[model samples]
Target: MAHLYRRRKQYWIVYYLNGNRVQESLRTDNERIAKDKKKKLEYELALGDLHQSSKLPLPMILEAFCKYMLRIRTAKSYKNEVSRLGYFLARSVTLSSLCRQGADEQRTMLHL
Candidate 1:
């Protein structure tokens, strides 16, 4: 379940996901719009359609990808891919950071 509240003249929604409380701004001051967004969020949550991958840490996602690769990829190929991706893990790169920084900035950061 999600509940809507007003803070600093803007509406926000709070809900629990997997026992963790998540709060997000509705980005609107209008009560009706806030209500609509809250309803939409609840519907998405109920259907499990919300894509939270952008908020996931990079290393966790990389680990999952490596596991999937291991199933179909040769050991050598998997090792090479993992080593390439390990740089991001070592630096604690995150999905959100990459999205915010844009592709060019990321390439520069990686010195590629």
Candidate 2:
């Protein structure tokens, strides 16, 4: 079984897997969606997995961006693009956090 709760207006699920407690954020406020996610998690836990596949790492994403930028931009511009991607990734913010902030602030940060 799982324990469902809300924190900072986000739904989370806590459950035991293989005698260990695991807590994860569902990242949604909707109860229906939270319930569905929790169900899926439980099912996956029964199968001895919380995820079916690994997500792309930050370095891999930056490498792809670098590859794309190299094809179109000047060397200096490509270097700046790589640096900016590294800066954003280092901050550890999610897309939702970016969307919640003011556009001007995001623009200033993106320019760096």
Candidate 3:
């Protein structure tokens, strides 16, 4: 379950995910708006679709992916993927940045 609280003038929502306590600002001081947003967040969390991926940096995500790949992929395949994705890591890419780009721009950026 999620709970709402006020901190100074802004309202915040606190919830748990994976046994971790996560808190996010609602960015509104109004109780009604905060309550509505809390409900939306709870619904999203219930559906298991509330991804925090966009907030993660490319290098961090790449590192986690590499760890997973190492467990199931051949060394050569893992190496190849790491090398390929290294380009994005070097450029400090984030999921939100890619999402903001146009389709053509994304294709060009991905060299596709």
Measured against the true structure, the TM-scores of the candidates, in listed sequence, are 0.49, 0.43, 0.49
Residue pairs in steric clash, candidate 2? none
User: Candidate 1's residue-wise lDDT over 4-52, tens digit each?
Assistant: 9899999999998777788899999999999999989999999988755
Using lDDT as the yardstick, the better of models 1 and 2 is: 1
Q: For this target, which candidate reaches the highest lDDT against the unseen true structure?
A: 3
Model 2 stretches with alpha carbons more than 4 Å out: 51-112
**Predicted candidate 3 versus true structure: per-residue lDDT over 2-104, tens digit per residue:** 9999999999999988677899899999999999999999999899978664678755555566557656776566545655665646746543343342435
Roughly what TM-score does model 3 have, to 2 decimal places? Answer: 0.49
What C-alpha RMSD separates each model from the true structure? Answer: 9.7, 10.8, 10.7
Distance from true location, Cα of 26 in model 3, Å: 0.6
**Cα lDDT over the full model 2:** 0.67
User: Model 2, residue 100: displacement in angstroms?
Assistant: 39
Q: Which should have the higher lDDT, number 2 or number 3?
A: 3
- Of candidate 2, the 10-residue stretch with the lowest lDDT total is 94-103
In candidate 3, which residue pairs clash?
Answer: none
